[model samples]
Target: MIDWKRNFLMVALSQFLSIMGFAFAMPFAPYYIQQLGITEPTELKKWVALFTAAAALTLAVASPIWGALGDRYGRRIMLLRANFGGMLVLSLMGLVPDVKTLVILRLVQGALTGTTTAAQTFVSVQSPHNRSGVVLGTLSAAVFSGSMSGAFVGGLVAEWLGYRAAFMCSGVLLLAAGLLVLLGTREEFVRPVEENGSSMEDRARMFWDKIGPATPILALISIMGFVLLFDSAWMPLLVQEINGGIKGAAFWTGSLQAAGGIAGFLAGPIIGRIADRISPPRIGKISAFGAGLMMTVVGLSQGFWQLFAGRFGAVFCAGGLDPVFQIWLTKTTPAQSRGFVFGWAVTARALGWMAAPMASGTVAWMFGLRAVFFISSALFFLLIPIITLIARYLQPAPQPSAPIHAGRR
Candidate 1:
């Protein structure tokens, strides 16, 4: 009776809006710190690292809890919470009195807002399992497309109206997204009877038990998440360096990210379809190698256009990494426990996100900005062997043969 296609379309639309809202102001964070009066380059870098890591730290802790709650309560509610929470936090971010206040808000943002994870879990629960690759891939495309639109428009908004205005616009978009989800999507989530009397400890143990078999895949997912985002916080600074000043730096950073978003938008569904047909491990290996190569080019680039070109290629290939792994995870895990497992998956990725800024910040602080890109490239290459080793674990389980009747034609 559930109209899954309609549900997917609605969820995808909400996801696009949600990610667009976040991207509007987030890519401009380092510059926002400057507006908050941290002009010293070292101080700026340190604060940037802190700002980026703070959210990841809390999200890492909060995701599994939210995920479990999604299963117990309803995925739709969790999706709404994420969008609405982001709307509030991001709006407040534009009004922060100081860098510390902004960082505090960022921490809150992480704890409350994980729209991507929430949306993905919601869609995963609703859609047919066989179509997971396409469904999730298309959802990822929405994310990339949203990011593309957000970054492009946001750059111009920041350039003309200033960073605060960009944050305000982000809030409005999230509000719209939340409303869309609230009114448009439907989830017939039946509460699991066993969860009613389960204590917190019992729930936690059950969650782990479901997730235990997928530990190896989740571990790689975490590492890949770190590799994917490792250079993100420092990218704005790199653009500044390339541009040779603050003038138009915000626009250029947004433009560069927008370019990558464009590539990711195109790559997501294509790579996803391919992943559905081919072995995800094989796709992962190829994507990782290409991403590493492109990242190296990005690191060595001397100008804005060169960086843009490299980023486009890198994002195109790197887009496959998450969706492919997600497809693999869906295939490996039990259906009923997906929400809990995915929450932990978000936690694993959050851990990676948490570590990336700190590590990249240290590298940029000690060596230089370009060094961070090189290190990120190396990490991408490292995933190749890891993916190969895990391919066995990710293989689809053998099916039982149909029993033959003696005289059946």
Candidate 2:
């Protein structure tokens, strides 16, 4: 048997570093976008849209291929790919002459790299089936922690140092993290089933075949995409107080982002492990509904704290969704197609992200930011029904292949 604790720690460490690098680059992108001096609302929208879309498009398109590659060649190879490729693209941004080059390279980076999937696959393979939720939550915790650090530090650093310096720093951090993954983690081999286990082999073969079908897994992915869009809308929906400069816009903005990341880090594990026991669909429905209720209440808020309270709730609800869905996905998938399915899932998530800024931003412009929150809050209610349907109708996934289960999961 594997030393589960040692392996999980290694993977978690790699994920923490990789996620930190990604987080470092994001908060400061707006500063660069503003520097480009194309601030017309529509044009600004287009630029922001294009930048996010590039990543979304790439992540969406590349996830399955990365996942597939991970399955056949080795999941470790995928991690190395994400690590090295990420270093290359981020470095380009630091070196690029203009915003155009940066966005183009970012999109390419998104297409080529997916650290999250690689990390998740690594843990999933080594972990006991029952403990998947707990392990995934631990990974989620690492991810959120990295982002929390990045956002808090990124905002402060960008404000202090120049934008170029921040970009260069991000590239360096990502490169270092990737090297750690290459040097430290061991790859677990996945081979064809033994002849004695013909029936099991045939069933496992079928799991691989199921990977391509756009089934409930994809549905979950698509819904998650919209969920993020809804989450993104929250900022645009901050209401008249922000436009009036209630109490330092920069602080508020950074605080909101940091707070959400923190909540995600703290709550992700609890939610994920709960899903392992109570069934994913139940958890999904509850979280979606809770998120909607909280966000809608936010739209009704007049005070900044009220708005932040809503933000916290929404983040908490959404935080657990990733691990829950990941558990669902890996469990249902055949080992051969785990990469493809997970990849496409990431791609779908990316598309949702691309749609978010535009959809919320445009709607906020027309109807007001509050309306954006109202609409998003309202829209999320649909997920409640969607997940309930899956829980009620679909067959439960069979038990996982090994004693990977650990923790309460």
Candidate 3:
């Protein structure tokens, strides 16, 4: 067997650097929108939602195809494609002259990049069974740490140098990370052979057939996408509201974004350890409910401290979901089809992201921003029942090498 630890370190470092670059400019979207000259508060809000939705929508369409290709060719190639493609598009975003141009580029960006998900696929496939939980949690921590650093630095950069300069710097960092991945990573991919007369549809059916017992797990994964949409669309706006000003808004927003990362960074592995000891579905159920309750607290907050406290708890709980999902998915999936499963699962998440900003923005416009939080909180509460169903139904069938078990007793 290959030394999964070596592969983990290489991909983890690549993810850290690449996401730091992406987050550097990403958290300043509202400020960037203002720079493009639609200065009305409503217009700014809508544009923020639009830009986020544009990329997510494209990602929803593209991630599965990339995953399918990754399953056939190699995940390393997918990582390279995402990193290089992101470097090009993100850098060009710095030069766009208008909101329209910027939005167009963001659309292309969705299709071209998703380094985190790709990295997840790489690490998941490489990890040993017993260590998958710790490995995935560590990767999540690296992601949060990089994002935290980027948000903090990007805020300073946006304030000192300018948003365009921040974008350029982000592109440069992404390029460096891509080079590291190219030079350091090694894979022993064995290409899948096509049966002489089988069509794409037949092959796909065969793939699903191999993992038929894990279907409910796939459903649970899709629901996770929608759960995130509520937060993604509104979290920045929430920070700006909590901070109560335009002056130094970027810094405050970045600080809050960093806070979320800090929670994820600290809580992810701890929760992963817990999941390994107890049950991942149990962790999933409690975390989902806890996250929802915290979102409600955030909405109800009337001051900075209240918002801060609520956001931290919410993100802390939310951090558990991905690692648990990853560990569970890894356990349930056949080794050969891991990439395909992860890719399609990511596509489900992209769809939720695509719908979330649009829905959150429209809901905020129609009902109120606070209403968005309440609705999101309700969604999490709603998820508890679904998770219970998943816990009961999503049992893995007996594998020759690994024993099959349900997520709960």
Candidate 4:
């Protein structure tokens, strides 16, 4: 048997590096776009929103293909492909002579990126069952570490150095992540079953069959996607709420936003085990809905402490929600279709992600943050009743007896 523990560390580190590299530009990207010559702050904000939307849309399209390919070729090779491709794009971003080129590259980068998916495949395919949650939780922390590193540095670096320099920093770090993947990782594709293994195509089909029956799982995932929307929109606005000035804004925003990831990192695994005992659907019915409400409360808070408390609650709930969601995805999904089913969740998350920020920020700007929060909170509360009803009426889907199949995409 392979030493799953040792491999999980390598996979986690590689993922962390990849994510941190991506985060390097997130907090500062808008300011950089404006500084690079946009001339209007409002336009810059719009442009930033556009970039966020583009990333979500592109990821929705690309994630399934990436997951599918990992199954066809192998996870480690596919990871290298993602890292190298992303590295090339980020590095070239530093050299782009025009703002338009930079914007185009940013859009392309989102389409090509698959850091989290790759990491999940690595852990799921490699780690033993009992250790999956712990290993994945550790990996989540690494992603958080990367986000923290990138955001904090992006803030400070953007202020001190030029935007070009910041891009260069992001590029160099991404290159390093690719290098780590190429040098530090190896694949050991675990067959879903010993006899009569299903083709990747078969697995994809099976995944879709369950998709309708997997309402609870999909709903939880869809909520996660929506949370991404809240997160992408709220984060920028939250920084402004903390401090009005756009300058030095990214540093603080990025830092605190990353703090949520840190909290999730620590909390994800612990919660996963707890959820396994209780069931992920039950946890999601509570925590996913609670995440939305608490975050809405954060938006409504008047002062720093109130905002902080709300943020703390939201992050805590979010931390609990993610691993539970992942566990539900794993449990509800059969082994053969696991990666592909995950891709669907990623797709749902991306699609919801596309809608959330665009609607939240655009509406919030006109209606005020409190009104926006109230709206979101109302919708969140509605989910509680919906979930309660689903639990009361829905029948459980059958788990794969021997790693059933989902036909190729």
Candidate 1 lDDT (Cα, whole model)? 0.91
The digit string of per-residue lDDT tens for model 4 on 1-409 reads 5676766777778777788787777666666666667746466556666766777888889888877666656677767777877887877877877677876887787688777877787678677676666666667667767877777777677667766777777777777877877776666676454233289877666555746556566665676567545655545555666677677676666666566666666666667667656755577668767677786777667666666567656776766656666765665555565566666677877887787767776766677655656666665666566656666655557777876478734
lDDT of 1 by residue, 1-409 (tens): 7788988899899989999999898999999999899999899999999999999999999999998898889999999999999999999998899999999999999999999888888888888888999999999999999999899889999999999999999999999999999999888889876644268888777756788888998999899989998999988998888899888998998888789889989988999889879989999999999999999999999997789999999999999999999988988887678888999999999999999999999999999889999999999999999999888765669999999999999
True-structure lDDT of candidate 4: 0.68
- Per-model TM values vs. the true structure: 0.94, 0.86, 0.92, 0.84
Query: Could you tell me which residue pairs clash in candidate 3?
Result: none
lDDT of each: 0.91, 0.73, 0.84, 0.68
Native-to-model Cα distance after best TM-score fit, residue 83 in candidate 3, in Å: 1.3
Candidate 2 is scored at a TM of 0.86
Instruction: After superposing candidate 4 on the true structure, give the runs of residues whose Cα lies further than 4 Å from its correct spot.
Output: 39-42, 96-99, 190-216, 301-306, 369-383, 386-409
Please give the range of 10 consecutive residues that has the lowest summed lDDT in model 4. 188-197
Separate clash counts for every candidate = 0, 14, 0, 14
Instruction: Please say which candidate is ahead in TM-score: 1 or 4.
Output: 1
The lDDT leader among the candidates is 1
Model 4, position 365, has a per-residue lDDT of: 66
